[model samples]
Every structure is written in C-alpha cells, then in structure tokens.
Target chain A: MDFIRQVLDRVGDKWSLLVIAALEAGPLRYTDLQRHVPGISQRMLTLTVRQLQQDGLVTRTAYAEVPPRVEYALTSLGRSLHHIVTSLITWVADHHGQIREHRAHTATRP
Target chain B: MDFIRQVLDRVGDKWSLLVIAALEAGPLRYTDLQRHVPGISQRMLTLTVRQLQQDGLVTRTAYAEVPPRVEYALTSLGRSLHHIVTSLITWVADHHGQIREHRAHTATRP
Candidate 1:
C-alpha cells in the first residue's frame, strides 16, 4: 500500500502526466519535449524526465556525435502508463461539462 | 488542451486520489473519511471532499437526526474514476519492483 502510494505520488503529479503524454508518440530531444508539453518550464521538464528515467518509465540516451544528440523515450512501463493517461484525458473530455455545471450550481447554492 | 490539463491538475493530485480511493467502499462520514485515508489532516480532508463535491464526483448527503449525520458517496462520475484509479494502483503493483531496481542501479552509477 505504501509503495503504491509512493508510486502514485510520483506519477500522479500534473507535470508528470503531461510529460508522459508528450512522449507517447515517440522519442524526443530535450527541447522537443519542452515544445510538446506546453507551459512546462525548462527546469521542470529536466526534473520530470529525470524522475521518469529513475522510475524506469523513460530512458535517456545520448548519442556520440558533434553537438551531442540526446533523446527521451518511454520504456514499456511508460508506454503502459500512456494508455491510462489517455483514458484520463478522454474521461475529462467526456465529463468536464458535467463538472462545470455542478460547480456553477454549487457556487449558487445557499 | 488547457482544460484537460486543469482537470488533470485537480484529479491527479496525491490527496485527491487517496480520498477518492477511500470513498470507493461506500459512503463515509467526515471522520470515517479521515480515518480511511490515512495521513490526511482534518483541514485537507475537508478541502478535498469539498472539491470532489464541486466536481460532481461525490455527493454529500445530510440526514436530519440527532447531532445531524452527513455522508459522502461517489457519484457515477466518481465511480468511473475509481476504475481508472484501481488500474493505476494495479499497474504500480505490477511494476514497482522494476522501478525500484532501476532506481537502485541509477543511484549506484558513476
């Protein structure tokens, strides 16, 4: 249970989800990752990917080349997580209106 | 995209996930909720429930009786979310060992 909670704490954060979703299509360079996940600061992206790598959900590879080429890609575990993240986004798309309506009604209640 | 991110921010937080999971069994009184989701402070539990209620994911019912009785139950929306949450925990259970091993290896790397 504690382990599950710790994992949740790592994966359930907003930035982590966004980062995971951004990497769903394929591997990306660091700058490309930032571009894919809008509004993420450089520092946050660095930290988020580092944590994902540490968790084995992502892999960072640096190719031997001039100017140093590096890429980030989801491991099998991270790809599995992509399915859940997509479902979550789909759920939000389907029900956000209901939630908004409820919030408005709640705001007006006595 | 922004709306999805905002919704993710609300539902993806650590305490929110724990609170939602705690309510999975059935309706719980405020005190019971606190007890069920270990480590949650009274103030946080109150705030978490209020947010869930506003989102229409939870329904709070107050029964007029001695000292008044209030209970919180998952709405259909919340129940649907429960399925996702369960999947997340299951995923964690399945893969945490891989993550831990990766972390240990990463820690030892030069």
Candidate 2:
C-alpha cells in the first residue's frame, strides 16, 4: 500500500500525467511536449521528465546534429501508466459536468 | 483539458486517493478511515474528507446519537474515481519492483 501510495504521489501529479499523455502517441522533443501539454512551465516539464526517467517510466535520448535534439519516450512501464491515466482522463471528461453541478449546489448552501 | 487537469489535481493527490480507497468497501467513520489508511494524520484526513465532500465525491452524514456519529461514503463520482485509481494502484503493484531497480541503477550513476 505504501509503495502504491508513493507511486501515485509521483505519477499521479498533474504535470506528470500531462507529460505522459503527451508522449503516449510517440516520442516528443521537449519543445513539442511543452506545446502538447498546455500550461506546463519549462521548469516543471524538466523536473517531471527527470522524475519519470528516474522512475524508469521514460527514456531520454539526445541526437548529435548541428542543432542538438533530445526526445522523450515512454518506457514499457510508462506506457502502462499512460493507459491507466488515459482511462482516468476519460472518466473525468465524462463526469466533470456532474462535479460542476455538485459544486454549484454546494456553493448555494449556507 | 484544463478541466481534466483541475480534477486530477484535486482527486489525484496522495491523501485523496488513499481516502477514496479507504471508503470503497463502504461508509466509514472518521476514526475507522484513519485506521484504514496508514500514515494519514488526523488533520490531513479531516481536510481530505472535507475537500472530497466539497467536490461531491464523498458524503458526510452526522447522526445525533449519544456520542454523535459521522460517517463518510463515496458518491457515484467518487466511486468512479476509485475504480480508475484502483487500476492505477494495480499497475503500481505490478511495476514497482522494476521502478526500484531503475532507481537503484540511477543512484549508482555519476
């Protein structure tokens, strides 16, 4: 349970989830990831990718060229997590309106 | 997308996930919930439950008995979130060993 909690604490965060989702279709350069996942600051993206790499959920590769290129792709574990998070995102999409309604109701209460 | 991010930010936190999981079996009093989710301080539990209730993922019922009884149960939205989170937990259980190995390898690098 503790292990699960730690894992959730790491990957279940907003930036991490967005980063993982951005990488799900394929690998992406840092700039591309930033564009794909809106509202993520450069510092937060860097930190999130570093943590995901450390956790073995993402791999970072740099290409040698006139302009350096770096790309991030999901490891198998990351892909697995991506699938679960995608499901969660779908759930949120389906149910957020209800949550909004509830929030409105709560707001009206004394 | 921003809506999903907000929802995830709220319910995807460590304490929130644990609290929702703790209530999945059924309703539980505050003390029972504390016991069910280890490492959660009373203050954190109180805040987490309050936030969940405000989000309409949890319901708090207070009984006017001799000692006063308060119990928490999941709303349908909360239950849906729980199902998704359970999948995430199972994924962590399946892959945490690999993550540990990755962490160990990363630690040894200069």
lDDT at position B35, candidate 2? 98
Per-residue CA lDDT of model 2 for B3-61, tens digit only, reads 76898788778788888888999999999999998988989999999888988999999
lDDT of 1 by residue, B1-110 (tens): 67667778888877788888888999999999888888778998889899999999999999999999999999999999998877776777788888889889999999
Give the residue spans of candidate 1 off by over 4 A. Answer: none
Worst window of 10 by summed lDDT in candidate 2 chain A: A1-10
| CAPRI category for model 1 | medium
Ten-residue segment with the worst summed lDDT in candidate 1 chain A? A1-10
Candidate 1 positional error at B54, Å: 1.2
How well does candidate 1 match the true structure in TM-score terms?
A: 0.92
Off by over 4 Å in 2: A1-3
DockQ of 1: 0.74
Q: After superposition, how far is residue A12 of candidate 2 from its true place, in Å?
A: 0.9
